[model samples]
Target: MAFTIPENLHPDLMPLAWLIGTWRGKGRGEYPNVPGFQFAQEVSFNHDGRAFLNYFSRSWIIDENDEIIRPAASEVGFWRVKENNVLEVLLAHNTGIAEGWVGVVKGAKIQLEMDQGYSSPSAKIVTAGSRLYGLVEGELFTSYDMAAQGQTLQAHLWSSLERQSEN
Candidate 1:
């Protein structure tokens, strides 16, 4: 579907208009400390005529039959965009980690590096992370790399999602 920038979007958000919608897709995850799993993910980016966009994501483990086997993870965050293309993203995870990212958005692509992170003593130490997001042929493509569990930065998650809501 053709995407039209929302008329009510703040001028500073024009560069991020492509991300304003709901998306759903499937993805695979693998890591050294955990067993690999297949998951169904849904992510949404929306704004209430405000200066920032509210972000939410949830994932569920699924079996071969595509039935949800168990809840996996969830996160809530805010993406703040400035007129100069500076971006600040703050996210809190159910795993007891909170991360703040700062970077720049160029056109439809975004690259963010972790600026600060805090975690509960019970949470795994996630010291740093970087994320990239872009739109390709109407699909939202996203990937993240992180340093955790004494492991160096490595691919942590990726997903390709189709738009599920109108522009």
Candidate 2:
């Protein structure tokens, strides 16, 4: 099937088209004063000639050797460009927050602001957070800062990847 994006959307988003597929890679993450956890994820990016790239990610718990153990929860979202080069994303899941964000996109990097996310089904709340994404030398590099777990910034997940066949 042809993955060529339609011509009408903003051309600026074209560079990110390289990431428009399913990616499987190992990831390392950390929390406040704690050792990092290891996981593998499948991140899928899809677009239908719209203003956004549909996003979905599912992770797996891994063993010490970075081998898969079992399936984990996931995140579902939409990533798009807003007015004045602002990038925005909205994500939802059963285990995680329903999040909304605004940001900017650089060549291979993105800086985002987390505006709102669901604390719970009943307790809806807004959050303060920033996300950075860049492709360094070939690997995917990203960092997230959020107030969800007591207003802190941490290097939650990091990965160096090669584009492989989709899951």
lDDT of each: 0.88, 0.68
**Model 1 stretches astray by more than 4 angstroms:** none
Least well predicted 10-residue stretch by lDDT in candidate 2: 1-10
lDDT (Cα, tens digit) per residue for candidate 2, span 38-115 = 888777877776667888878888999877888875889888876666887898875646878888876778888777
User: lDDT tens digits, residues 1-167, model 1?
Assistant: 55778878987787788899899988777778778778889999998888899999999999988799999889999999876899999999999999999999998899999999999999998988999998888788888898998998888888888889853
Instruction: Find the number of clashing residue pairs for candidate 1.
Output: 0
Which of the numbered candidates is closest to the native, going by highest TM-score? 1
Each candidate's TM vs. the true structure?
Answer: 0.94, 0.80
Q: Who wins the lDDT comparison? A: 1
